[model samples]
Target: MSIKRILPLLVVVLAGLGALSSGPLTAQERPGPLRIVIDEGVIEPLPFAVPDFIAENGAAREYAARITRIVAADLQGTGLFREIPKEAFISSVTSFDAPVQFGDWKAINAQALITGAVSVSGRRLTVKFRLYDVFSGAPLGKGLQFAGTTASWRRMGHKVADAVYSRITGEGPYFDSRVAFIAESGPKNARVKRLAIMDYDGANVQYLTDGRALVLAPRFSPAGDRLLYTSYESGFPRVYLLDLGSLRRRALDEQPGTMSFAPRFSPDGRTVLLSLSVGGNTDIYSLDLATGKRRRLTSAPSIEIAPSFSPDGRQIVFTSDRSGSSQLYIMPAGGGEPRRISRGKGRYNTPVWSPRGDLIAFTKQNKGRFHIGVMQIDGTEERLLTSSFLDEGPTWAPNGRVIMFTRETAGAGGTSALYTVDTSGRNLRRVPMQGAASDPAWSPLLK
Candidate 1:
């Protein structure tokens, strides 16, 4: 079937599945066949099972197994679903169309079941899957099929996993996204930093710049086709925009005696917000990409940096030391009187507005400890998600349910690495990287 036909079919199937519950529910009061309640307290991950996808032909056998494993890994990585080992299965899923042995799955306490099939024709690949509510002995949603090139098998797996995750949790999909970061090498004093991009799970690492120059704070454009970062190639910190397709870059706001850094793209991707330092003063300015015009957003003597636009482009959240200590503040998008949003004791920096627009994630340093935290847009209900020797530069996932940040160890030999945690502060784990990495910025879900 053509992709045009496949998408509409998938949408119709998903719609027919019915609306999902949005609030937390007790096990006894859970309204759906399967649900994951994200609460303040500890949560027991729902048990799930995904047998190897049935290969429709001999050529598809290997692809089927790989895709199945990827799907399971994606679900388990969320800390919301625990996969039941294949060895524990009482009955095997031998066919894609076979009715699931609900009693067999329930016996193992598998709350959710996933069945799939894979087929290959030359360079074309197709994946089909069904999610079941084991206890209810019914399909949670109609079966869905995805078609793509064989080289994109990994994405096919991610799409299936995204569908399963969203259906069970009532959250958006995030599995099929990319992350831009500063890949590091050499010793701490003279470390080499290069621009790099990778899959959300740190797969397919591709270096975008040579390590000859220092790079920091890679921010993805709204369309995910370009990046805004700071580079020291010209012997001074300056903002540079890099195009991913052409691998070309150009410095922005290149004034005679001014240095610019800490750049971020506005939600619409037409304007760039950056901190430009002239003489002894630093302020925030918005640069129009098309006309190369600069508009100052803050005219304060106190330093203001790390500005991020709200999803709707109506407001901006940034860090300023105007309160004597670094704290987060919000101002109108077009520059106006600022409102202090962070009332916490510690210093706050690198405030990133969540894509959902309900929360802002930031790095906080207090006493001798550093932390990554999130709070309501108004800065209420501040909750720290992580604390370490040096944790800074938080970036939100596309769905805003997770935050990825740079965490450095201590001492001279301390190395930086990337870590992710849910907004609830659960499932803290390091992303797999060959060497030290930091300053991660997640891209939006890929089209």
Candidate 2:
């Protein structure tokens, strides 16, 4: 089935499912927000000490240390945990079951502690771990254990981070999710694009579509099982929703018009928000698959493209030239007065609402240079996240902690690639691609 083919059916399933609830579940249940979970973003990074994991049985000593390091790195990467350096540990974890020395840890300003035991029997590996609140002198929760193939040590490491994060922050786990984006190759004039999905860290890459036809703006559903993209296969630049798993596609021309592009799924996966252009004028609209109905949310003479919904699904933030110059505007999802939410020297386009619903990240064209920026919901506190010849198409990660977009250089041999940056505008990392890439839309945290 095509992505939007079951799109109609998925909406039915989602209505019964409702907004994702909180809590972690087994493989049978989907991942959702955790009720009464720790707010990792607001909470201070807990200082924790994870001593070198103790190897029981015949586990490789080298592999055990690597697993411990990966676990520590995952926790630290979330910006929610501060790992105590190996030298700072005045005490060592002699055993996983041994009582933690709260006094000693507290003296080193360690707020939490991690201890684990690893054992290997034949091809199977078993890991048991515990987390503790050092400052409170109490166990964080019951010890967690996992049994899997010995080769899955890295996955086991991520699981450890998920447990530590979930116990302290009420938020759901995101460590195990994956992301899909366009992979590019060939020259600038004749670029080839392929649908590339990979684990969040760029591991386990799978090509969903061959880089033959022209494709643009692909985004995954919240479950990461489907993708909504715009393809020119219809010969007139119409939006086509393709099921990543089935190599099937159906044109999303709910509007009988010739052009509909820049497609993205609403947070609930019930509606697809995209732009419809007619007679040279473009506007934003929503396609309600369940009712087989569509609602034009923005009706203006000027161009209004790249419509993104707030996490609550009550309002939308989009790019419009209503002010004589392109800028960001926020309006009710049902259609109403739009308040301008972007300011400063240049025109803003492609405004994407962060999943956390606190900020609107967009591409700003200032002077002659293009830069990516984020602003408060009410249009206050704007900060640039990237700058260059052309930096555009900002997409927010599920946690709203990072922003991913495309960066294109200038000149005869212009270059473009996908890049991700923290909300702080730091840690700009270029994602690997065979050729040029653009219009990256980050997928919602998968269940």
Best by the TM-score measure: 1
1-447 in candidate 1: lDDT tens per residue?
Answer: 222221111111222212322233333354665987566377788899999999999889879999998899899999999999999999899988776799999999999999999998887788888888899887776677888777677878888999898878878899988899999999999999999988888877888889888888899999888899999888888999988766778999788788999998988899999999988789999999999999999998999988999999989899899989999999999999999999979899999999999999999999999999999998899999999999999999888899999999999999999999999999998998799999999999877
Full-model lDDT for every candidate: 0.87, 0.73
lDDT of predicted model 1: 0.87
Which residue pairs in candidate 1 collide?
none
| lDDT (tens digit, per residue) of candidate 2 on 1-447 | 343222111100111111221223332232322122232235456678899888886555656787798789777766667888989888898776676788998899877788887877876776777766676676655667766666556666667777777666655566655566777777778778776666555555566667766778888776666688877665677777766657667887844555998877877888888899988899988888567588888889999888888888899888899889998888988878999988788999888888778899999998899998999999999999788989988877767777888898887678778888777776678864455566676655543
Displacement of residue 271 (Cα, Å) in model 1 is: 1.0
How large an RMSD does model 1 have?
4.8
Stretches > 4 Å off in candidate 2? 1-69, 78-95, 98-112, 117-127, 133-138, 146-155, 165-173, 244-247, 254-257, 431-437
User: What TM-score does each of the candidates earn?
Assistant: 0.92, 0.76
How many Å off is the CA of 154 in candidate 2?
Answer: 4.3
RMSD of each: 4.8, 7.6
Candidate 2 Cα deviation (angstroms), residue 262: 1.2
